[model samples]
Target: MTTHHPTQTTTVQTIFRFLLGGALILAGTSHLTWARTEFLAQVPQWVPLNGDLVVVLSGIVEILLGLSLIFLARQRVLVGWVVATFFVLVFPGNIAQYLNHTDAFGLNSDLARGIRLLFQPVLVAWALWSTGAWAAWRRNK
Candidate 1:
């Protein structure tokens, strides 16, 4: 008897997933090193943790998430959900930067910061779409 297996993803999805993974890796590295100060500017001042400490910890988390995105295809759906959640969680920091008028990463003006805010949802969608998480969830439902 012969058996057929189901395909999990399309070529385009795989390409986008890898691209997202690579981007995440680069962003995470910057968070830890060269862009550390810029990342601090995004932290909400009211956050109890020291800004530097928060940046360092979040950088570590980003690195791990990037690695998971790249090497954990079998678990991509789970990773996607986690990554999307992370993006949502950090959104308040982005808002705080805009509301507080903090300048960092060249987002000096309100227009620049406002434009940046629009990309967060895109990133969340990218995580779900690239990993087929959205499709998988719908399929289960």
Candidate 2:
């Protein structure tokens, strides 16, 4: 919890927040379009719902979350938590992909899949930091 000048914090967070929003929008769009197969690779076999359905639903959720992240600054902290929870909720798919050695999104080998495993936390942290959700939690705690 290193502190920065409020101006710096606000500026940096704004940039990251926008970037994350745009990324989510793109990802969500892809889920319903050309990258549908790529996203399907991340859906674990254990899920009772059809993998395509899961991808579609998750994509819609991503779009909504991304839109909220960009447009709802007043509720950014709560949106951030929801976004982080989304990442957490989907992490099992990532793990299953790695364990099952499924290739998609150019992750062709164990090394690549393993590396991707590391980024999930980064996304969770990004959702938190870019929206001050972590700080809010800290304050409440």
Candidate 3:
């Protein structure tokens, strides 16, 4: 007989999850406050909605997602999926920033922007790992 236990989260994973949640909250606050103008640079030109509106809305979303990550441990797997999806959804903005050479968040150089673009997938992976979402999905397969 084979016994398979679900993947359990480690202390490191919990810490990272909290850290990521805090980061998202801080970033979202910035989007609505001191860094609002800088965030504008990330809004792709093709997005028909007003850049200000988009930034504001995304800020709100980030805050809500952050809260979920921090407080929704019971639903962490779902929250992880949502957070990872959010990372994927925002990738185009990162790409647009890099391609358009729009400076924001001190990523003034193309290299810097390019590097930031590379981190999106890391964020997605982080969300999945920290919340055990990847483990859960894999276990079900």
Q: Pick the candidate with the highest lDDT.
A: 3
lDDT at 102, model 2: 96
What stretches of model 3 exceed 4 Å from their correct place? 1-7
Candidate 2 on 59-94: residue-level lDDT in tens? 999999999989998888888999999999999999
* Candidate 1 residue runs with Cα over 4 Å from true position: 1-7
TM-score of each: 0.94, 0.93, 0.94
Determine which window of 10 residues in candidate 1 has minimal summed lDDT: 2-11
Measured by TM-score, the strongest candidate is: 3
Candidate 1 lDDT over 1-141, as tens digits, reads: 943222277779888888888888888899999999999999998999999999999888888898998899989999999999999999999999999999999999999999999999999999999988988887778
RMSD of each: 2.8, 3.1, 1.9
- lDDT for predicted candidate 3 compared with the true structure: 0.93
Winner of 1 and 3 under TM-score: 3
